[model samples]
Target chain A: MRTRWIFGTILMLTLVMGCAKKKIETYPAGVSSNQQIGAQTKPYVTNHQEEQTLSSVQEQQGQTVEEQNLQEEKLKQAQQEKEDIRKIIAKRIFFDFDSYELKPEARKILQQKAEILKKHPEIKIVIEGHCDERGTEEYNLALGEKRARAAYEFLILLGVDANRMQIVSYGEEDPLDPRHCEAAWAKNRRDEFKIISSK
Target chain B: MKKFLLFSLIIGLFGVDFGWAKPLRVTIYGPAESKIYVFVAEPINLDGKKNSIMVQEVVQCIKVKLKLFPFFKQLSPKDILEQGKINDVARIDYKKFFLSRADIVITIGERYLPDTGKTRIELRTFDVFKQKMILGKAFDLTNQRQVVLMVRKYLGDLLQLIMGNKAFFVNPIVFVHKGIKKSSIYQIFADGFGLKKLADIQGIVLSPSWSFDGEKIVFSVIQHEQHKLGILDLKTGNMQFKKLPGNSCISPVFTPWGDIAVSLDFSGSPDIYLLDKQLKIEKALVKHWGIDISPCFDQSGSKMVFTSSRLGNPHIFLFNLHNNQVERITYEGNYNTSAVISPDGRLIVFSRLTPEGHRIFVHDLKTGQEKQITFGPGNDEEPFVSSDGYFVVFTSNRSGKYKLYYTTINGDGPYLIPTNNISTFSPSWSWVEEKYF
Candidate 1:
């Protein structure tokens, strides 16, 4: 009984080795092998020409993964910079009744805006000046222009390029708040920054 | 006694067709106390019953037009009818009018012609003190809508006989109506009828000024964060916007030579500049460093009055175009603005800001006298002089919401012009020709 089992194991080992040799010869020489022969021969040739093609493909995929990771990092950074710009330009400075002089808080806010503008040299901005409803429409227009010019002059003094900024005055029109109260008036008299271009 | 003889001589010379032949010269000045009493009789319907409503409408319109004359104290028809029945010129008792202290009596007769579908109105004016029929006229109207026009025509002729000055009846006023999201331009007759929306701009409209021919209007509009020059064709209803090279565009006025003069800040400060009809910069008219704005010109365009901050505050300055001379006319107030010259170029009307509120003031150029024409609990601003130089129209918030109000040069009447409930601003009055109506 022992002699019969040993003969059967020897016969199976010989059959597996013969099939592996045939797959290596056929696949390396650009010959199409049957599905059954290719499936049976996959595990045997780790150091053959078939092995070289598999390892080279793995290396190419590894390089692509690294490149994709780098691209995603750059996209995230650009989105973050855009969000920062939006937050900074959204801040508006207030003014007093019939007055265009900048207060202390306004100066501080303008300083921060100047710093951002300095960092982003490609950005262009327009400063809009507005007023409350207490004065005549014509005079208020001149007053609003004075207010916008005040901000423009200040931004110029802060090392920002003069050519990078433009100013406009809306006078007593285009109020930020429509209510006829002190609080609304305070809000209406303001200077708002708008991004004209960023590239 | 002399006044009576002069009146009789004038009436005798001109006869019944006096207003058609030549305008009579009669000058009456100052407030209501010095005004002559005018008695308007209740209108009579010739058909007695069929045309009573039309007659009433005509009489009502006549009364409204009479109120616009500050030199005439209108006696209510009820008060005159209570004295006696005055159905015709022959039935008018001069003794009763004299008893009522009426200096003049006006009788109206309206008859509807059923065949032609028209109404014929006969108007007569009698001098009560002289006891003479001074004027008579007839008007034919095809519809009820012409009642205001007929009244205006009759009053215009009657005014020609009473006062040699031009009448303010057929003239129209353009003003700004402040809405929620935007403001619109509206034109209304001086008699408070025919209110029309000239333009519904998408932004705030300010300082509307009429052209000399009354065919176009120039105004400033705030849109897209800047002030733009807007020209509206009154006849075609077409609007044209021009982007001026400045951060601000303020009050714009049409020069007598048919050009535009506006305030622009292109040279780093607000200054008056002249532009052609196409809105091209012709030249700088008034250039200064201290915020010059609100340019107003006299009838001949020889003199211009504008508000300037050159003297540390806004004050009215008169600029003579002929001599190139600039003189400061207002020295009383720190805040004086929106000054308009009278048609006769003798008086300047403006608004002055006080502790209480803004008030209308008239500065006489000849007499060098400054008189406050408005005493307001709320702000009164944007005073515009009538063509006759007797009436001044302004916007006031005395009735809780800003509306148009008219007073005489002597500040006699503060009658409210019915413009519904919307807040109005910047009334610009112009004398439109009758054909344009």
Candidate 2:
């Protein structure tokens, strides 16, 4: 009786701990929200029935491990993907002064970027066009947009879907390097990509 | 406290006398010849040079006012007095002005009234050619700011008497100067006096346009993470950001009927939209596949001039409101933008990109001839017509960085606006008519 009692207590504690952790497995999002609604609707069950519910919870936990591990693995992969997006995108493409014409080297870089974009069709991006410190601000802003459009069109030509691309121009306002040198201006005059969504 | 309140009330009436709307003509002056070559004498302080600093500051501010006058020129009465020994302030030295090659001799004398303990200013504008004083007035000024501003008011009246046209000698000019983190909008008197920072929107503030009534300003503020459209009311000092139905809104202008014309990317492409006062979209003014930006309303309010890339490159276009017809206005340039019609609604002034760099050009609607006003060294863009339509002010990088330069619409200049050495852009001239109310 003592061995079975200790074993049931341990299993019951593991069931509570596992369910708490599974609630925070870092997003498929539906699990936490569903449990939130469940907590609201039933606030608290009668505490006297804790032993019976604990046994039932242990049975349900044992049965869900196989199925939940697959979902948990998927959630893990999605979390890794979020990190990979944070760590691994070469999203900025630089341009020349007063010219929106993509350079040959820029085109080469975009070719590789285009391939990555094609592989992830679920990702949507916003291309922010920026300019160096030159010209009237309005014209530079328009020029920046033209640079973004040039890049967006080139990506579209390379088979990236048009619906996934968005563009905005910040003119000569937002500089990537913020220095007034040739190399800095070269860096400042470019299109930077931000992933809007993955799902 | 009572003196301060009364003095402030005087300045307040002088300011509200204009209501920050349009300036009113202040001093009454005699009629004069079409040209006034003003010879400004040194201001004399009564009570043994007690208010000499007050007199000197007033004279220098007056010199700045003369710089904007198209016909007026400054002469030194010291040179006239040096030629002939005339040290008298009250005595008439009329021949000294003619000898100094002056058409109008302006002499200012200050006396401290001990009874009131206020500085009483006596300004006399003597017509050298007509051989009589055209404008002479006595002002009891309690403060120096009021004295300087009062002198500027008389100078406006003096210009009207000389040039047969009224000008805003003391009117404010609003322009954008790039600051440490972002560009800020600033207002100064037309003579580059009385600098006041209107807004320090810490990003790129571009293409500032006045409300139809010249009470508020609408500009495009581009920050790193976001872009905004800001409308600042000069009366209340309240700046409200207008939320558009899109990602970015640029190049906001006001129609004569108080409607706002702005360009935004509502459909993922920048297109011109007309918005009501509440910032609700009244209509998509120019819906194009590519970008249609920088829409400026003409004087009649029925037509607009904008830049579009539908022809493969950015070029200025004209849109008529009646028939909703769009027409290409510029045929020469591959990149031409910032088109504003002259106040008279006759000519158009815009900037064109060339191998040398960006230069301002004025195109005649009647003659179809374009004259480039700015040349070489730096790029000049964002030219707008002055309210009088006689001249234009624009931002130019002629000195390696950016500054405001005003020139005649005939391409007569790239005259620096005498501001501090900084990046100044998008100068919109608000020329107020002189009213004597």
Candidate 3:
């Protein structure tokens, strides 16, 4: 009887270990830049501000025009590297205003995202649906959810596993741009991907 | 209590306080932060019930206690003080306000102290452009807290009326937050204050609509691997669920007699259904070409506002139950969906896709004028008007996270729900309670 009890304990421990191992086997989907996309300055403003700061730094260095050009190129390259990190950190799929029906442009973006998921099958992702400032907060949230769901379904159709994907809607609480312009509004309506974990 | 006693004294002064040999004109200036000056009529009356002069004492207390409404100061005495004749309400001329820049204007009935314990505080709201009184409010206060509350509520209201409601206080907002990924449906307040988790569910829950009573919320939920319609009692925190046949249930609207009108797309394309209080399918409301979704019952449940894709693109359409006549309401936007009619049924707020992106817009059914409410980055969509029709709660990515935001109906600074935690979405705000006051 003691031997049998010991055997049962061993089986329970093995099952727990197996479950943990399975969860750990999945590769983290999407890049985790921890870039704090929100804490960063508005995208448009950040880009413009970086350009100005780069120019000032070049002047301070007292480099030749060609040297300044080289330095500027390096700055651009560095900024691009950071942005590349942001992109890998998460891929944002854009959408048309109000319509959750994936636009042709959105399909193209999703195709690229699909490729990433295919390359990283062990990764799990959460698709965030977003909207611009427009309607009621509640409605925008639902629409955003729909938008994210559209992207999720598209990916699933593209062979992405449903278990590996989850969706959440931010509605319009977070805006990539804070301005009240058409350009800003367009940027706000989007579906973005976040990698929850890696195998 | 203190505020009330002080306010009463201010009222008393209105009669004898401003009245002087020469009516000294006074005007409140600057923002709420600035000290409001009285521009008194010199030396002042040294004797006028000094002990019982609660108004002066109250003014002194306000000068000391409140940071916003400061004690009135005396402006320089002049028969015709210039300063550009005080054109705007923000900038008023003492000369124009009072013919002479003297201290006070003694006008009968301008200040009145009733014999009863209750004090009637009369407020005259003036139009800056016309320099004429456009509205008036009378606050009957018997105590201090009531005085403070009255002042706060009415002062803000008056400010809104003066500078327009758009520039005023934070409008009420509503949104739903899920637990982790899928948990319960919670409502977000406008000022980002009250958060009440309305439902507990294991499956997916979707759009919620306010009943005419505003006490119950009707929302679509998925449970037991089946789609169901649910009504949540705000008071009791009890939820009643009625199962539908298919796996897809979208918008749910509550009608009279506890009946619900819902748009169920489970049967291929979207269609409308009327369900009794028990969640039993009553009948099909509409089964036509294309998809029909986002149905909201009007005040009387006589007509419903819904989105239909019959015309190729989705647009808001009204369906009359009695006549079975469907008419399109929006023509400008290519995609206009998720329309919620106002409590009075005179206005509708909806989400429209424009060149600028998805935006919340309010359409005046009478005037045929559509006013855009959201601006900036992220698409603001699926706008639901509050029961009172004062504000809208919508979703935006202004926080770089899919969270909820509240905006005044006019769309000023969208009130971002302050949360850095998990994202919130698919907010269906309950109607404002009857006791919004």
lDDT values for all models: 0.80, 0.72, 0.60
How many clashing residue pairs appear in each of the predictions shown? 0, 0, 65
The candidate maximizing DockQ is 1
What is each candidate's DockQ, to 2 decimals? 0.51, 0.22, 0.05
lDDT of 1 by residue, B166-282 (tens): 446667888999776688999886667778887788888889998878888899887776678999886787889988997788898898888999999989889999998678999
lDDT of 3 by residue, A1-199 (tens): 9999999999999999998686444323352325434434544334457789998888877667778799899999977954654476486767776667888877887777777677767778878778987654434555666787788889889888888887666666568998877799889999888777767
Q: Which window of ten consecutive residues has the lowest lDDT sum in model 1 chain A?
A: A27-36
* Candidate 3: CAPRI quality band: incorrect
The candidates, ranked best first by TM-score, are: 1, 2, 3
Q: Fill in the DockQ of model 3.
A: 0.05
Which regions of candidate 3 deviate over 4 angstroms? A1-199, B1-174, B332-334, B388-390, B408-422, B429-437
Off by over 4 Å in 1: A1-35, A38-81, B1-33, B45-51, B76-82, B112-117, B141-143, B165-167, B178-183, B235-238, B432-435
Model 2 TM-score is 0.72
Ranking by DockQ: 1, 2, 3
The prediction achieving the highest lDDT against the true structure is 1
Model 3 lDDT at residue A122: 71
Can you write out model 3's per-residue Cα lDDT over B1-437, one digit (the tens) per residue?
34444333232122322223111221211122222333322112223322234334333332332222222243443534552233232234434654542332211111234676654544433322233333345555565446344444444453343233321123333345555335566655554434555567765666766665567777776554345677778768788877676434667777755678776644545578887767878898877646676777666767778887788777888888779898889998677877888756767888887776677888877777778878847677666665545557777765566777666555545766554455666665554432231
Give model 1's clash tally.
0
TM-score of each: 0.83, 0.72, 0.49
Of the two candidates 1 and 3, the one with more favorable lDDT, higher being better, is 1
Report i-RMS for every model.
Answer: 1.5, 2.3, 6.4
